[model samples]
Target: MTEERVVGLLERLLQAKVGHDVARLIEKRLGRKLEPFDIWYDGFKARSGLDERRLDAMVRERFPTTDAFQQNLPAILEALGFDRDTARFLAAHIEVDPARGAGHAWGPVMRGGKAHLRTRVPKGGMDYKGFNIAMHELGHTVEQVFSLYRVENTLMAGVPNNAFTEGFAFVFQARDLDVLGAGGADPERDACRTLDAFWSAREIAGVALVDIGVWHWMLEHPDASPAQLREAAVKIATDVWNRHFAPFMGVKDSPILAIYSHMISYPLYLSHYPLGFIVAYQVEDYFRSHPLAENMERMCRQGRLTPDLWMKRAVGSPVSADPMIRGAERAVKSLLKH
Candidate 1:
């Protein structure tokens, strides 16, 4: 069910004429023709054009130490609509630490243990990227707490899969600017956000296809040498790009899809990202006018049901790209008309 829904969405996105139109719009915004690597375009985001140095300075001033970020968790949760007690309970259950790597959330294995959120903090303090990552990890920690501490059964103590957690992470990541008091609600901005989500979803979907194809190639030629595997990986990536990305990117046989480190380091893990985006969009849409903290607490407490079942319980529908696609289409029409 998950595979069919994701693949069906990707196919529709690839075939949709809006992909080309949105590509042109993005190119105009960029003041250049599109390139194959533009699949990862960031211009539609509000922060894309901001000076990183300025953002870093702001973040450093706000969170000069890991403890500073940690101390603010309750307030952050409160700002998202959690009551004082609920916010404090969640904050008490999560521990923040400086990470050696990018950042990750480590949930507790036993009751009465704290969930850990590990994120990098440089000597200068947490920069914008680190803070953004911290917020993402915070989302995971919150989900971890809700799913574990609030769940009725210890056997069902997490979301169904990584994609669901990733979706929750995105829910928090999307609100970084809001948390900083840097932006507010606007119809145009909301529309752009939808388009941004669509483009990102479209990009990773192709990369995932390549990831799947390359693994299949490996299975078919198990005796192939390292050189042969590398050649096959590149060929599969190029083929996937040609089929799905070339029409919009105006480049053929681009190996850009194979550039993700996960393809080499984390076998068969690429699909979760695009699927995460789909889940995020659907979950976000469902809670658009509702209280996020309350609804999120309820949803996470559903615990380890199957993905389709969890989604059906959380939202009114199963995981599908239709909501996001329809949103992007409306956004495109609205943006282009003006």
Candidate 2:
């Protein structure tokens, strides 16, 4: 059968099983219809005149210091309510053996272990992207450590899935600036941050949609050939691209979505990107007012606590638009105002 025909059949099967909610959610958030070629296109270029180079630089300059990270841990753990023993345990996990190459996380809990953090910098990255990734990974490590040892059981340890963890990870990832001592409530920089947040939210939200739709398609079309699955993925991605980001790029049929290796290797991980962004916002808000002592270890212990319970107990709310979309919008608006 032709690729299009096979995809159509797959979509039918997916809709039958997982329902069309994923597609509908994508359309609702994006506020438009998706074409088959708009998926992977970067949507941020149109706003802020920012480029990846600058962002990368920002990440590199920050997040390499044990002292800087230490200063922030108390507040971070306080927000999560971690204790001393747990803090030490988590600190040990993130002790930076240095032998472990860059960008490595130990154990499922990202915090209980240290990340190798392979920075592009010859002397070591001192830029935003690298720092962002490091911090992002740190957030993952924090959540990982908390969930694994802090929480009750392995079964109840982290959030629901990769998407939930990703959300928590993004909370720290977005804080690269604050961690680096460069970001804050400054008007101009805050506007930049706002723009970046919106752009990222849209981008990841789209990716999550694609991830959900593709999986739903896969689950339904068990008999679908790999080639057919690839085709379906492309179409969905393209459709997503045009719907949310087409106007900014002024281009269509971008093969960008094809690059999401996560879709192929980590089933259901795509949802985490957008979910992580949302969850991160909520967590950040929690830290804005709340403060923790040297209890990194205590926070690390609360792993996998269902999204609902974790959010309610951790921040006193259900996981919803407040942390994801609404919270983001508020942060962006505040940033823009300054």
**Model 2 C-alpha lDDT per residue in residues 1-338, reported as the tens digit of each score:** 23243333223222231112223333444577754343332332222345657666554444355444444454444334456665555666553323233454444533244433232333554455445555566666666655665566666665555655676566566555554444556554543443445445556666666787788889899999989998999888888666554544456866465567788798766655655555556666666576532322343455555666666776778655443344434544553344
CA lDDT for candidate 1: 0.86
Off by over 4 Å in 2: 1-89, 97-102, 108-129, 152-155, 242-258, 292-302, 327-338
* Alpha-carbon shift of residue 37 in model 2 (angstroms): 11
Compose the digit string of candidate 1's lDDT tens values, residues 1-338.
45656567667766677888789899988899888878888877867756778888888998999999999999888877789999999999999988899899999988899999999988979999998889899899999999999999989999988889999999898888778777687777777888888899899988888887888888899899989988888898898888888888888989888887687688878888888888898999998877798999999999999888999999978777777777788889988876
Provide the overall lDDT of each model, using Cα atoms, as 2-decimal numbers. Answer: 0.86, 0.53
Error of 1 at 293 (Å): 0.7
